[model samples]
Target: MSAGAPGGGSLDPVPEPTGGIEADVRRLAEYIGGTERRLAALPPVPDRAPHDRDRAVAVHVRARRARRAFLARHTETVYGVLTDGLTRPVRLADLVYEAADRFPGLVPTRAQMAAERRFVQAEKEGREIDQGIFCGAVLRSPTAGRHLVETMLRPTPRARTLLDGFRTEGRIELDTVYLERRGVAGHIEFRNAARLNAEDDRLIADLETAVDLVLLDDVIKVGVLRGGTVDHPKYRGRRVFSAGVNLTDLRDGRISFVEFLLGRELGYVNKMLRGLLTAPSPGDGRERSVGKPWIGAVDTFAIGGGMQLLLVLDHVIAEENAYLSLPAAEEGIVPGLGNLRLTRLTGARLARQVVLGGRRIAATEPEARYVCDTVVPAEDMDGAVDRAVEALRAPAVSANRHMLTVAEEPLDLYRAYLAEFAVVQAERTYAPDVLAKVERRWQERERRRAARGSVR
Candidate 1:
């Protein structure tokens, strides 16, 4: 049998090589060299602004269709080459590099953002947003790493399914939270306005669920967390971003201390930081990030737990009148993950002052700039958010976000601090001293309310 021929008879003597393995290797080298030369010769992709929203939508539709076809044919090979049993970060970086090499301009840019807005408007008018085009850019774009795709490939957990159901038929009807989707942005509003938008157990669960839905939705690229207007007669039509945890529930023993800690740590805070993951199956506790960017729209106040939650967001746009504080020290508890994340934002000394001293940080203060990306007048909030969302929708935004998070606050650091926070917060929640302090604060609030004739 000839050496180059397949299915030679076993008894046949081995034939001399007709340009054997070396020749095959040389051929591969030549092919690669030719491909590289061709790629290098190609001109850079041109940039164009859509004349209008409809034109933008058409551009996205065509690009997404092309991307989907490409991925359908190549995804398995890409996954095998980039993500088999690799550590998440390495896998992600390699995938980004590879995608950028293989498919330039695959990631949607500003054009896609305009298209998404049009798509969202159509959906509101009873047209279905095309799922086929929703995540194609994510795969084609080098900005989204393989870790995100791998996470999506896993089966959706039942808990997550239930949470998603809360927004069935394009509307979320929870009493404590208001959820709305605008183009590629998801808005989650804390709706307990009568209590100054303070988070109670139910509100915590609902808010967590809302965040999960945002993470799960492939079409949503950014999420905005804001608060609703105050419902009290005196404060009617006025904004109250959040007053933090519902101290009344804590004082009256209406909420479980441990459950509150878990809900906040895992449900809200962790979900924002690490993204959502299904309950780990036995022997598989590996966590995956949801990979969605979050924006905080602080209108009036973000106090205590509210302030702590802001640490998890990718960006913050606070109203000029907004104020933030972490007063857990006064209440005899460590602020949830505040020490860890706050120190990174503000220096250790400033973090200590804010957490320990219960210093209220006005939005206009230079210190507030450490936490918030921008502080705009309340009237400009809508415009500011629009600009911020547009900025976030850029092609490389996801890659930039991932690299920034990994470098600035690695996942391991967050996990370690959260572990300590869960245990310490649970113990401190019901401590006699802590309870006494909370009760005293509650009484003081009541006295002030009575003195004001319950105006506030």
Candidate 2:
């Protein structure tokens, strides 16, 4: 009873395949028939197609599958390679040597190059980031501009992620935005350390949107006279009725200081000033329109271009114990920006005396007529600035506008602005003749000292 099925036919287990052979055979045949049809559905190869090429096709198919899988896992690396290939190849040796030469590992990466190129392109394009807080409009009160302030989504580093991807945002021109930040009461032209650049001419031509308040901060002072080097950033510009404040250079010892100032580090600031003076803020209805001048907190040495920044401002606040110097003359280089500014503020004779003398004048020196305003202790600097700002702010708007317009009446100021490049050309010629030898001598001494120290 246990071994036998109900009818005893299946008592002995069938030794054959468990699946029905006939059914399985039918299914197999159908699968084969389908496969045959699929194969036949393909377009026939031309007689001209090479026989070896068919082997190539199989290899390609296999490679494509493998590649697809590989790319899925290593997408970042693959993309990096693709980007590297698309760009001009930079030899590892060349990059390494460049790193070794001065700034180790500071070689621009592909991404950095791309960023720089985008920055350059943005400058080339007319996409202006309107950081000018004034925009040729003044607020009724100190915080009034804040209420009216509506930032345009420009491609600055801060605003980039806030708006779009890291694309270019054209050259910037400094406007009242500077003054608004400095807490100035009235409109004055301002430029910060950010706006100094080597290619100022091109930037001016393409990026000049309007001209109004020109603003620049004298953050550092570097001068050489009589066998001494005065290197610092902060300097007193023109202070009319207040204790002067000083702008100091915080990043003086590093070698990258020069490149950083002229390159991306300071390019935006340079653009800001260029844009403002080139294109002043439009005047308000029945009133003078432009942003007021103000100096925010400054850090870092303002070398040649930085020193020259004093000429742009009408007033200054110098912090106590700040160093001011112009050593470009000693280095066989012309102080391009400083020369222009000096020529404008002082007569040609005084300008030459101050600049060509190549000496660092003290901020409080009474004998040197270079300082425009009174000097105050660093502690009293801010209070002085506040008083000056209040005084300027209280003036009738129309009167302030008239004064600014009149300030530009001098032929020297107008000419300097018009022919800004005269200083540049002069620098190219004078820098080598006068300054290069001095710089080389300094460089050699430093090298020798470094070598001796290394031996020890």
Candidate 3:
């Protein structure tokens, strides 16, 4: 018997189901088809007067929930069959897209609603919603899988040599970052203490280089990101994790949109996701896990982009007093990747509270616990990180991490999220109003700092 090609293509003659995985695939396809039919039967959004909009939205929401419930019921089966090596991995995204396309009324296509919400929010609140939420909503749309597949299929820029100008077995210090391989873990510390370790273009570049070095080093089994000493009066002689992006550069127009995207998405985050020189395996054609497990050691606070960085980490150890916030809503910018990954940790409601509501999550808060795996006293942070590192370096931990990563998050999700993020952020970053707002806020911040005599 031959299995039909996706999207009603000519039936391709294939081998009969061996009554194992192939049988499972057939069952899953049947379920998907059934769900798609049910979705197709739902009433489409109304195009009439304002009075009908609410009813149309309600109907659409109901259909979306039903679709979600169907997907949930068969999630394990779908994930298992897709990753079972029966079909080409390259076709997975296409399969998801086809399944989604079958149900046209699933929560309104992303393209339709993407700009509407932004405009509505801006009209009501006097400014647009955080770019993170705007972009995240688009990425989470049912049709987003298509965009994600295209992104994963796109080639990444070639990385520079890890040892291009570095010494072999000693501590390496750049202008704004520090790196040292100690035994099984490579420690990459953000060292621009004077700026509260805020990441500028140079700092981002150095951090990416450090990540590459950690990936290139065979002796390194894990990578750790933390902060070095801060000499400012308030944080003198203390570790202060990071204060996120350098707002000064942003306000001064020194940061380019492409630079920010490449540095975060392609540079460090991709390294964290794809690992070092690891290509997809021939058998499964899945991206291999060559990246080491990452442990984030947070002291003080991780704000804005700093908080977003935590999403890519495998484990996070934060100090008791450490707080995390994504104040992009107020800053008139988007927190990179935070919306896509934060919701996975804290759920949609709380993620919204933080991203849209501008809530600051204390380290001891329940939401903070969800984001950080472990919290310790400031003094015990070092010990906790060491223990976590030791635990991560245990036998089979790397393999286990890789398996869980693939089974749970998968590379395509990140690709899809970032692909949308890149476009949306580019638009927001260069918008005349957004730039003006950012600069005005920068001036306000400077004025307040000067009045307090704490300007850095």
Candidate 4:
């Protein structure tokens, strides 16, 4: 039905609407609603193979994306209406459902609604519809996606409650993440100690809270992100930085799109890039909050997701012995924005090696310099971070930092990339071989774990 729709020959951009905004919205709503209903009423395919199911679901997904992109074309006109005058405080997780509830001619069925939100764990509750079908469709819309991103940036009620108390407490600690003001810097330590600070669903809230504290606090002028020491025998008592996404959780189906994937990118990670959306960025009114510069201190290794993050940080201070890699192929999922950003850092060829080839380049390797700013010995990391903080503490630094980010890659670029990324990542996350790959990785992890225990 559309150009970008799967089984359609092209991934070309959806054409601009030829009709009036109001007329287009009405007509497209009817079309999209009818399409969704037809998709929902299709005969069940639960007994089919994985790829067969995926093929069936992909058609619905592509159609949904086309509808999302169509909405993007008219976002300026229809957005507020769909979102009910923008008075309600809706976060990314709940954004679409609110819209669907408020309006019609969007996702027709409850299962379609679940797929739109990527709630894989929640039972379908309907017929044999695939959950990944429309997971990122809403996010694919430019203004709508940014609106969701901005919504996520608005301080959470819990964070605001913690903030008032945290101002005086000067420190807040959660099970897997903690925030403390160190001089002029708000330091956030990733502390999934038993898992080497690997990222997962459980880490998003606490980590995001820590990030919110830094951006909202009056005293903190700069931010620092680092990994905490882990309990794993091989890396016991040594800060392992980030072992990247938790394969165990990923394999076990514990992760989700809105809560984890979209949550990380639109919540904490992008929060670090764009800052808190206190006043919103829709009009001439300037934002009340400013984006803060962060210095990432890497120890040991930053794999997959961690390496993707290095691209966004203001300064990356890596230990001399540390290394980095973006093994996206092995993980069977896109490495967030790495494909879009890594080329700027390492160029096309090297980026291909890192992302496609899964090449782990150590800090000593000259290629690693492209990703990290200063490689310091483990003992000197604290001093290097302090110096970076002191240098970045200038009030005007954020102005230049945001400018640099835009110059390197505009927000529109990120917006457009994420539109497609939302769909692709959802699809790949459920790839047939992914669980098998995770099983292999799990086996290797256990073998290594056992070997370490024996050595101990």
Question: Top TM-score: which candidate number?
Answer: 4
lDDT of each: 0.60, 0.31, 0.62, 0.73
Query: What lDDT does candidate 1 reach at residue 101?
Result: 42
Q: In model 3, how large is the Cα lDDT of residue 153? A: 32
Candidate 4 residues lying further than 4 Å off, grouped into runs, are 1-79, 87-89, 99-142, 281-286, 443-456
lDDT winner, 1 or 2: 1
lDDT of 1 by residue, 392-434 (tens): 8764776566677778777545544554554456446645687
Q: Candidates' TM-scores?
A: 0.61, 0.38, 0.63, 0.80
lDDT of 3 at 205: 69
lDDT of 4 at 443: 79
How do the residues 271-359 of candidate 2 rate in per-residue lDDT, one tens digit apiece? 23221121223344123222333332112223444455544444554544444555655544445446545665667876665668766
How well is each residue in 29-69 modelled by candidate 3, as lDDT tens digits? 44434433432343332233444444333333333344344
| Model 1 residue 374 CA deviation in Å | 0.9
Please report how far candidate 1 places residue 342 from its true position, in Å: 0.4
